[model samples]
Each structure stands twice: as structure tokens, then as C-alpha cells.
Target: MWRTPLEQTATAALFLGIIMSQIVGEGSAVKVLSQPGQQVTLLCSYNYEDNTHIPQLSVQWRGPNNQLLCHYIKHKAYQNCTRGYTISYSPSSITLTIQHVHMEDFGAHVCSVSKPHEFSDYSMELARMSEYVTSAPKSGGDQSGSTWTLIIFHTLLSVCM
Candidate 1:
């Protein structure tokens, strides 16, 4: 059986559309800190074919020791936060506030957004601890104690997940 040229062209166009849709479907990137402790907002944006339902957005702050300090899930009024950290969000952004800034707060933080069937994620890092604070005190000791709390919290997240 011989197929018409128009049919072949339509089939080729459909295949190309499907491939392009998958490539540009959903993705996100965490913005670098324009400045530390200045109410930094991490943005997680995604593209979907349909927008009939409200999407779920999750944001987390990780400490220097790869620990989860704060987390927020959409629709939940309460947050899971570490002792010195707070979590909040808007429609398209999640913000983590670190009070009385300390060295342990320096590390990679991740922001993730998800819908019923699709999701996106991103990561950012604070290169130096001193960047968060202008003046440095002349004191040195094991800072691990302060960060230990975050580590424990991260463990709980792992178990729950």
C-alpha cells in the first residue's frame, strides 16, 4: 500500500511536537543569593500542558553539613523548621529566614515544585559564612553543636520520606 505525501508530512510533524513538548515540559533553577539574610526568595517555576488544578510547592533550607533546617509544603499552614530558621512562601516563591545569622547556615539549599503529575527542582549555595554577616567576632570553637540540630531534623525528614 502506498501512503500519500500529506500523510507522511503530518506524521513527521506530530512526532516532532511530541519530542519538543517533553524537552521543554518542566524545569527550574534556584537563584543565587543577591545578598545574604536579605530575605532571599527562591523561585521555582515550571511549564505544564494544562493548568486546571493548584500546584504544590515545596522549599527547604539545608545547612553546611547537608542537613535540612526548614521545609514548607503548600496548603499546610504550619511549617517544619529548625530552632533558628523560619519558612514562608508566596504564589511562586519560597523564602527562608535565618535569624541571628551563624556560620552553619552556609550550604546548599534546594527548592522544589510539583503538580499532580509533574515537578521541578533547583539548588543554591552560600559560598562563605562571613558573607552573611558584616562584622566578625574574635571567637573560635566547635560550631558543630549549633549545626547538630539541623542534622537531626534532616534525619527525621529522611525517615518520613
Candidate 2:
């Protein structure tokens, strides 16, 4: 059976659409690092030729274990922040702020964005803390507390040494 010219053109256009989506779906990548107990922020950005055509930007954050830590949908944040996290976004940028970093928060993190019919993403790999911060000695600390303090002090000193 012979296909009409209009039908043939439509089929070709559809095929091209799929190929373009795959090409543009893969976004960029970035890496970030911070010390434990400190705050950190991850950023994401997107550009469009037609500003008005810009699609809604969806942001997702995944932890080292591929766990879903947080997400932004329709300008709202749904976060499972273990120690308090926040999401901020605009037409061109999306920012994820994580507070009170811990050892468990180390390692790879993924950020994804979904827009209209296209998608983009990036990844951030957190490095191990090189040192730890010491807090003021507690009033009337027990003997065990002092011992733990000494141990931690030596550890930090050794690293510096």
C-alpha cells in the first residue's frame, strides 16, 4: 500500500522528535564538597531560546545510596531532610540547600530537572571531611567525656601533623 505525502511527512517528523529528545535530555554535571556538620548547597540551571516557552523546572535530589532526599514540584518543596534542607528555584536556576552535613551524607548525589518534553540533570560527589570541628567543653563534664575529647583532639592533631 502507498502512503500519502502528508502521512509520510508526519511519520518523519515524529521520528525526529524522539531523536532530539534523547540528545537534549542528557544535561551537565557538577561536583561539590563540604565538611561534616556544615551547610552545603547544590545548583541547577537551564536555558531556553524562547523565554516564554520555558517549561516548569522540576528538581530532584538523590543521596549516595540512591535515596530520594528531596524534590521540588510546582514551586513547592517536598523534602525528607534528615537535618533540615531547603529548595529554591527560579526560571533559570534551582538551588538545594542542605544543613548539618554528616558522614552518611557523603558520596555521590544526583540532581535532575524535568521541563516540558525535555529533561536535564547533574551530579555532585561529596568528599570525606578532612577534619572535624571541636565544640566548647561542657560544664561539669564526666571523666568519659574528657577521654573522648582527648581522643578526638589527637586525631585532629595527627591529621594536621
Candidate 3:
């Protein structure tokens, strides 16, 4: 009967350009499906006419609640990355690695990058399979198949958006 904070944040992110197609090489929305405590990576990549400007770029990763998870500035990740997450950036891409994903980590993730002339940002949704299974209607009706089908459809649709 109630929506999770993750759902609310995802909706807000969509309205705030997080769902928009970015100028990145990869697809705009990256969806990562994982178990409860598996490693997951959210990839944020971009390309520019010039590679020399890569060093001047700044990248940031935010959680589903819009909390700052980590940031890359001056070619180094901020202190937040030292805690449990690892962020690495190359000239063309930035990757945020969640060493051990938890339920709290299952939701929308945002990656924002800014350069001199190009700025790109988008959101990625990370979902857990258990939630999908356990959160279904408990009326003894068969819905797992449909639930997975819907999830896939929406994931593909969001990426294309």
C-alpha cells in the first residue's frame, strides 16, 4: 500500500533529467540486476571531440536518496569512495563499484559528469530479485512470470528513453 523511497526518488530523478538521454557513448539508463550482497557496477561514460580535457572533468555518483556516494575530482575519488565504494574514471568513462550491495543499495543511482563544454548525467536503477519475488501479491496467484516480464519491459523502455 506504500511506495518505497527508492520509487519516489526514481520518479523525481526522471523529472529532473535523470531519465533523459545523455551525450554518453553508452545508453542513457543503465540497469543493474543483482542479488542481495553481490558486487555491482554503474557505468557512466562520455565522449568528446578532445581527449585532453578529460583531466579537467568532474564526476559524481549519487544514491537513490540523492545522497552523494562518491565524487571524482582532480583524477581522484573523494573521501566517500574510501569507505565502501570504489570509483574509477578514465578519459571516456567513470565506473562506480559497490563492493557489497545491500537492500539499501537497490534503487536508482545517478551519475553526473561535467566538463568544460560538455556535461552529461543520467540515472541507473539497481534492483534485487528477491524484492521482486517477495513483494508480489500474496493471494496465491501466479504473478512471478508477469512481474519479471514487466520488469524487463520497463528496463528496456527506460533505456530507450
C-alpha RMSD values across all candidates? 20.9, 22.5, 10.3
Which regions of candidate 2 deviate over 4 angstroms?
1-28, 48-50, 53-55, 75-83, 132-161
Tell me which of candidates 1 and 2 scores higher on TM-score. 2
Tens-place lDDT digits, model 3, residues 1-161: 21653443334333323223353234456555666556666767567524455556688899988888888885454435736799976677678888877788878988887767777776788866433322346577677775765554456436644
The number of clashing residue pairs in each candidate reads 0, 0, 0
Per-residue lDDT of model 1, residues 63-100, tens digit only: 65768877776656547988867776655455665654
Checking candidate 1 for backbone clashes, the offending pairs are none
lDDT (C-alpha) at residue 111 in model 3: 83
Report the C-alpha lDDT of model 2 over 29-127, residue by residue, as the tens digit. 333445666666665555532366453456787888988777777534444444477777676666666776778887877777776786766666665
Q: In model 2, how large is the Cα lDDT of residue 79?
A: 41
What's the TM-score of every candidate structure?
Answer: 0.46, 0.55, 0.60
TM-score pick, better of 2 and 3: 3
Minimum summed lDDT over a 10-residue window in model 1 is located at 128-137
